[model samples]
Target: MERILLQLSYNGADFQGFQIQNEGRTVQYELERILKRMHKDFIRIHPSSRTDKGVHALMQYVHFDTTLSLPTNKWQHAFNSALPDDIYINEVTKINADFHSRYDCVGKAYRYKVYKAPHRDVLKRGIETHITETLDTRKMNEAAQYFIGTHDFTSFCSAKTEIENKERTMYKFEVIETDTGYEFFVIGSGFLYNMVRIMVHFLMDVGRGKRQGSEIPAIIAASDRTKAGKTAPAEGLYLEKIYLSPEELTQDIPKGTTITLKPTRRQLTQQS
Candidate 1:
């Protein structure tokens, strides 16, 4: 058996979520279905991260063990042939059996987009959240700085999450103003359930003059979910990228390999 790693992107509007559920459609279900067809047997794929329903992925990674020995380039073509147009397999590589797509990831980056307008952009609906109120980007950026570094994010996670440890390191958090709206880029060692969405909500609150930027520290110290703003919509979230250690990344893919995929037209408009 050989371990294989694949990089892919998917538009999440049509699926329930990344993981397979008993009833609804899912990205994992479609992927595994295609893999079963290729191998003529059951195959399971482990993803780098789990995204909520309507959360898109720009560069998602997955790994699985397979007995088939197809060339790396052909693997992409074969998988793309069966997968839906919204999902595309960009690259594939052979990897060591010990490498894991999730546990081995050292860091990840996520992006949340918000469009400020009196009315929703019909073209970008369901991909970018629309806010009728004007947002102060400067104040949002100031609030975002407080989220950098390590902290117990209990106040910023969903109440439905069962994880006990809420400590995670925030390597970078910045709010960039775009022509149409704002883009929140967050990089972290790890994140709790709905952590990014809650952060975005709080930042938006700060931008709307409903909260003070200086209150972030005290809110985080509360360790209560009620202290944070409401969770943002899942449609605004995107799994921007996943980072692996130099050693782990080099073990499979060659040096200078570019894993970034070109953003689709919808993604481009959202960023704009």
Candidate 2:
């Protein structure tokens, strides 16, 4: 058997989530179902990250082992032909048995889009978070800057998260103006569950003049969930990219202010 890695993107509006559940349709379930039909046996896949319901992905990675005769170059076409239109396989390659989609990931980039205007863009209804109020992107940018560098993100994560270690490094957090309004881009070594969504909500509050941009440091230090506002809705969030190597992580993220993301905790422990 050989290991295959597939890079994919999906419109998650109709998906229950990335992971499979007892009920409801899911991205994993669809991919696995197609694979089972092709291989005539189940082929388990490990994903780089799990996105919540109504979220989207521009670039996501998954790896699986198979004994099938599919060549590396043709894997993408084969998978794309079988996958639903909402889910597309962008690329595929063969990798070493030691390579892992999740554990080997060094960094990830996520973007949250907002469409602020008097009139709604019906075309982008489920694609962006729409708000009718004027927003101060400058203030949002100022607040986002405070998130740069390593910190305990207990206050920024969902209370439902079970991860024991709350510390993660934020390489860069930027607010860039787009045609639709603004997109909040975050590059990090890793993130706690709902961390980006939570931070975006706090930044939105700052943009609305409900809070000061200068308060972010104190809020982060508090380690209190109440300090951060409610999680931003998932429809605006997109998994922009996944970086498996330190070099790959450094080259991407346009207009990034920070230099490098710290290695994952597992990498640090292994080195020690």
Candidate 3:
């Protein structure tokens, strides 16, 4: 038997979520359906993280075990051939049987996109969240600093979340500018359900003059979810990357994943 790790990307627009449910399509179900056909048996896959419905994943990771022998290089092609266009197997690696995709994950990064336009760009409807008001990025950045350290994030988590331990280490949280919008990048040891989105919404409130950057500490101390503002739209959220190596989880983000802003294709075309 061998354990195989696969890196994938998916547009979560149609998925109920990464996890299997009583109804609706899911990333796991689609991939496993393809796997069962290939192995002639059910193959369970363990994903590193579960994203909300309508959220996207740019570099998600999953691992599975199988006794059926198959070339590591051939795995990607086999799966992609049958999977829907929204889901694609990017790379596959044969890992030791003991390796786990979820437990072994050391860190993760997420990007929440916002398009600050008066009218919604229908093309980006499912890709970016639209906002009509102007924002003070300077104040937003100042608010972001409050989230960049170890803290009990009870106030920022969803009421539906079952996890009791609300403390999570936020290694990095910053607002990056794009020509048409803003991308809120957050790297953390882990997050409670809806934590990142709630945090981002609070920062946005600061930007819009509804709240002050200085209020974050008190809000956090309260540990009340209502204090954090609304959760950001799932469609605008992307699970950017999962970091399993120790280097990426350090208090300071590594060189390769340096927290720098780069204009996206939409921004680039507008600039040109």
Model 3, stretches more than 4 Å misplaced? 251-272
TM-score of 1: 0.89
Instruction: Order the candidates by lDDT, highest first.
Output: 2, 1, 3
Measured over all alpha carbons after superposition, the RMSD of each candidate to the real structure, in angstroms, is 8.1, 4.2, 8.0
lDDT of 2 by residue, 95-141 (tens): 77777889888889999999988887888877899888878989999
User: Deviation in angstroms for 60 in model 3?
Assistant: 0.5
- Per-prediction TM-score: 0.89, 0.92, 0.91
**What digit string (tens of lDDT, one per residue) describes model 3 on residues 165-261?**
7887777788988899888998987888988888888888888899998888998899898888899888889999887666546545844443321
What are the runs in model 1 whose C-alpha is more than 4 Å off?
A: 246-272
Flag regions of model 2 displaced more than 4 Å: 253-272
lDDT computed for candidate 1: 0.84
Residue 217 Cα positional deviation in candidate 2, in Å, after optimal superposition:
1.8
Top candidate by lDDT = 2
